[model samples]
Structure formats: C-alpha cells, structure tokens
Target: MDHLLGEVRAAGGVARVASLRARGHSRRTIENAVSSRALTRPRNGWVAMPGADPLLVAAARAGVVLTCHTQARRLGLWVLEERPVHVAAPPHRHVGEVKRDTHVHWARPLVPRHPDALVDPIENVLVIAAACLPREEALTIWEAALRLELVERWSFERMPLPSSARDVLAECSSHSDSGLETLIPVRLRFLRLPIRQQVWLAGHPVDFLIGDRLVLQIDGGHHVGAQRRSDIAHDARLTLMGFHVIRIDYVQVVTRWPEVHDVIVRAIAQGLHRAA
Candidate 1:
C-alpha cells in the first residue's frame, strides 16, 4: 500500500482508485486508507490525498476535456462567479451514467485536433470551457487562456457552435469580463454612458473607461488583503496623474446598478463640464 501511495503521488497528485486496484493495491488496503482519512474520494473512481482540490482530482479522473470554470481556475484565470464543474466527454461515452454532481456535456463529432493542447495530451479544455461557460465568464476564460497561451483564438473560432452559442461568443469576443466586470459595462450601456471595456491605464487594467480621464474599477471579493492594498495604491497613483478613479464593489455592481450608474454618470458629467 505504501508503494501504491508513492505511485499515485508521482502521477501528479491524483489517481483513480480503480487504477490503483488494477496496479495490485488490495481492496482492503484501499478501504483502510480511505477510512483512515489518508485518502479522499473526489469522484466515483478517483481518489486523492485529503488536501487535494476536488476540481483537479475530478479532471484527472475523467480523462477527457475538463474545462469552463474548472479550467479557468486551473489556468489561473480571474474568475468571479463559481460555476458548476463542466466536463466534455467523448460522444459515445456514457457520461450521463457517471451520476456525479458535475455537469457533463457530451461532444459529438470531436474536432480533428485541439489547438491549445495540454501537456497530458488532453483535448483543448479551453475550447470546451469557452463553449460551456456563460458569455461573460467565457470572455474572462478566453482572455486568460490567451495570456497563458493555453489555447489559441482559432480554437474557439473553429468549434461548430449552435446559433445561440455563436451569438454569445460574438458579443463576448469584443469585451472581456468576469461576472463583476460584466455588470459594470451592462449598467453603463443601459444608462447610455460612453464606456470602454478593459481599458489599460498606467500598466494596470481598468474595467471600464469614461473618456480619457476616468477609470472604473470593479472590485470582486477576491480583491482583498494584499490585492486590495495594491489596488488602492494604483488608484492613488492614477489620481496623482490627473486621472479620476471610481471603484465599486460586487454588491454595488449587482444589486444597485441604477444607483451605480447615476454616480458614474454624475462623475463623468462633472469631469466633462469642468473640462469644458
């Protein structure tokens, strides 16, 4: 059993219990380790160390395209909302019978070859992720995938998508946002404010731009502690450069869109009026 544990650890920190069993680990040994809390069952056939992230374990077990929020987080994408675990299985595989909490979507007529391939030779998880994620979340994943070079833009372009999915991708391609950033732009657009999405300022990225001077920041919960402090310092630096910075939190962006819009509109009007 100790030898089996070493083998599992060497295989990227995850392995299927069935694989271990096939490799000569006794059922009694498996049960004992699981009972001792030395191992955890992330999915039906997969088991890992107690501290392993469940998402990674599941992806490793499925042996197919594990993506969307799962891949985004794995690739270190800045994701705001937690989404269901999405996996793309081969067309003939009976993923539906797996009966796990994950949302498994089967892909019929698989692509000839995935563009942004993984080191493990898995199909382009990024493309599957982009297809399944919400429009806003997809955009965030797409940008992160590009920055990491995990997948190419052509991979997404090449997939055969339903009309609705294609439309969502088209609209989202022009704007990059997680859920929080998406809210800010949607609110600004509804209020008829001239705002640009993902505008770069002084080497830092701002969520929206109101003309040349005002930068809009959407602060999600993840932006706390050291990150929060860094953001404050960046805002101060922008202020020193004669730029106005308006920051809003997730609650303001989600529940108080009108109030948020009014505040930004007033600020923009004031800035423009002063410039005039």
Candidate 2:
C-alpha cells in the first residue's frame, strides 16, 4: 500500500486504478490506500493523491483528457493563455461541465488516442492546437516543443498534418529562446526583409539583427542585475558601432502588438535597419 501511494504521488499524484493492479498490487491494496486517505478515487477507474491537480482530476472524472493549450501549459511549455480548461474527448462523447469553466474540443486528433491515457500526447496536442489557434500562436507552441526537446523536428515533420498545420510548421524555428522571441520574427515575416537570429555582436549575441545594423532585443522578465547591466553596456557599444538597438519587453510583444508593430515600421521607414 505504501508503494502504491508513493507511485501515485510520483505519477503527478494520479494514476489509473488498473495501473496499480498491473504493477502487481491487488485490488484490495488500492481500496486500502483510499481507505487510509492516501489516495482518492476521483472517478471510477482513477486514483489520485490528495494533492492531485484539480483540473486533471476533473478531466478524469469527466471521461476526457487535457489537450491543446491546457495540456501544453501543464507540460511547462511556453503558453500565452491560461483559462477555460481545454479538454479532448471522443468525437461522440458529450461533455457536461467537468468542474466549472471548460472549452471542449471536438476536432478529431490527427492520430488515434490511447484508450487508457488521460493526457494528450505532445504531438497530438500540437496538431490540435495548430487547427485551433491562430498561426503565430500555434507555431509558438510548436517551436516551444522543439525548444524544450519535447519533440524532434524531423519526426514532427514526418507526422501527418491537416488544415494549415504544415504551413504553420514551416515557419516554426527552434532557435528562439522563448515563444516571445518567435513572435517578433513571425509577426514581421511579411516584410520580406532579412532577419538574422542570435547574431554575434560586440563579443556577445543579440536576439535579432534585421538587415545589417538593426538590433531587436526581446527582454523577458529574467533579465536583471548583472545580466541587465551587461545587456545595457552591449546596447551602448552596439550604438557606438552604428547599430540601432530597439529593446522591447514581454508585455509590448505579447499584449500590445499594435504599438510594437508601429515602432518597428517607423524604425524601418527611417532606414534604422539598413546598412549605414
């Protein structure tokens, strides 16, 4: 019983009752774990630790699994939204409010889902997300998956893609440090201008170098103290070298896109991104 409880906790505080039985624990032991309050049967077939994530438990109880953005967020992938629990069920299954707010996805997964699995596979999540979210956001998740080593680029390319997913994946780049890093180039791809990533300059690397002289820096919240001071000093030296450095923060790139776009356009108009 102790082993079973520990195993459940190790499995993100959740496991199917059958999984415990398969692990050589008898039915009686599972019931005993529940009786001892070390685990709770959130659904008929699922046993979970007391601290199991409520959203996942709810998905289990509702006979569905987390998918798309919801599963991406849970997997520690870069995600921009965190609301309205996104779940996947069989195309025929009817959902009736798992545990308050929910967004039920009816799109059939590109590949068949595992019958006993309670979480969407990473590739399936990306496939469904490609069809559900706008191109840029979907590509961000795909790039994030690539960045995190959650999936390999060649294998993902080999997988079947429906709708505009193939086109979206074509734009995906694993070179980005974050989803926000991807955002800048993806949003500006229409200009047909040269954009280089992780460019070496002044004995350091800048995020993006447009044309020959423009340096576009996407600063996440992590830039601080010595790192921040170093970046500032680099910005000064780059300017002295006749490079135009345009630094923007998370909010500007993610939330206030219009302003960021306008600023970039003005910079280009003034030939800041051109060779001096």
Candidate 3:
C-alpha cells in the first residue's frame, strides 16, 4: 500500500483509488491510507495527496471532457468566472454518474469533428463558458484567446452554438479579453464601429484602428502587471510614430460603452485634425 501511494505521489499526487483496487490493491489497504492522511479523498473513488492539483484529479475521475470555465483556466485560456467543475459528456451519458459537486453539461457533439474533438479544446470550452459568464468577463476571455491564438475567426463563425451563445457572441464582439478575442471582428460589427479589429502598427498589434491616425487598445486586467509597463513604452513609441493612441479597460468596453465610444470619437477627431 505504501508502495502504491508512493507511486501515485511520484506521478503527480493523485490517483483513483478504484483504479488501484482494480489493479489489485486491497480495499482495506486503500481505506487505511485514506485514514492515515496519506491520501485525501476529494470525490468518490478519487484521491490526491500534497503534490497533485486537485482540479486535475477531479477532472480525471469524471472520465468526460472536462470543459467550460474549468478547462479554460487549466489550459491558460483567459477565464472571467471561477466556476466549480464544468464537465461535458455525451447526451446519452447519465449525469447521475458524475460526482454531486460537478456542474455537468450534456452537449451535442461539435460537428465536422475529428478524433481530437471528443475532448473540448481550450477554445471551444471557453466559448461555452463565456456564454454563461457576465458580458464583460466573456469579452476579456475572448480577447485573451485571440492574442494567444487559441481560437481562430473562422472556427468561431462555424460553431453550431445555441441562440444563447449567439447573444453572448454579439455582446462579446465589441469586448476584448484573451477569453474571446477571436470575436472582436464580430463585436465591432455589432457596435457599428468603423475600425479595424486587429491591425499591426509600430510592430505591435493594436486592437482597433480608426484609420491611420487613431489606435484603440483593449486592456485585459490580468496582463496589467507586465502589460501596463509594456503599454507605457508602446504608447511612447506610438507617439513617436505619429499615431494617437486611446486605451480602454475591459470594464469600460462592457459596462460603460458609451464613454468608450465617446473617447474614441474624440480621439479620432483630434487625430484627424492633427493629421490635416
């Protein structure tokens, strides 16, 4: 039993006790380890010790595609909400089989699917999670996803998402975050903003371009620590390159959109006047 526990810890500190039992570990031995604090039971049949990420252990025990906000965070995709475990299984699968603490979604399979599609990629899971998140949070996750290239524009367009998803996508179109950055083009159209969604100027990708004069930046707060310093340096460089830059926080784009609109309009006017 100690040998089994040692092996589990070496392999990332989590293992299914049931799997161990199947492999011939005695039930009494497993229970003894649990009682001795060598293993901590997070869910039925699953245990983790000091070395494993509990979330990963939980996901492994469920035996389905771990998804939504949970998977998004795991894959380093930007996530706006901290949800409990979100797992997606086939429609035919019984939800009762899942542990009580998990939030399970039985979804229709995504189409044109490859073998890899059985598991929700970080991008698809985030799109689903974003649909459930607050509009602002969804936008941040979207922008971050785009910057990271986790999702592509065409892939988002092609998804057979529900109406609820479409509504979220429309809201996310104008918002920016790594979570759903792929939807920026769609969002800009919804807002009727006559600006390029992503344009390269002065060697950095600017979020929105209102002609050659004005550049709009969508600042995702998570990146703020390092990004704030980078933004300061980039703004100085843009000033030298003869482009007027206007920056907006993720909150402003979702909550105070009118203010963001007004700021952009004023900046564009100033930029045009200066150019002339």
| Model 1 clash tally, residue pairs | 1
Clashes (N, CA, C under 3 Å) per candidate: 1, 0, 17
Global fold similarity of model 2 (TM-score) = 0.91
Q: List candidate 1 segments past 4 Å from native.
A: 1-4, 16-65, 96-101, 109-124, 152-207, 212-214, 218-245, 254-258, 265-275
- What is candidate 1's lDDT per residue for 116-147, written digit by digit as tens? 12112222454555466555556555555555
| TM-score of each predicted structure versus truth | 0.57, 0.91, 0.58
User: Which tens-of-lDDT digit does each residue in 1-276 have in candidate 2?
Assistant: 778878887777778887778889899889888888988888888888897898777877888889998899988888876667788887887764575667778877776776567789898899888888877788888889888889888887888788577887888876799888888887898878999999899999899999899899988888899989999999999999999999999999878989989988899999998886
Question: Candidate 3 — which residues are off by over 4 angstroms?
Answer: 10-13, 21-29, 41-44, 50-66, 82-85, 92-103, 108-127, 130-187, 191-194, 197-207, 218-242, 250-256, 266-276
Candidate 2's error at 96, in angstroms? 6.4
- lDDT for each candidate structure: 0.63, 0.84, 0.64
Lowest-sum lDDT 10-residue window in model 3: 109-118
> Which has the greatest TM-score?
2
Query: Residue by residue across 176-275, what tens digits does model 3's lDDT show?
Result: 4344344344444544546666677777888777666677777875557777898889889988888888777768755676787677557655555145
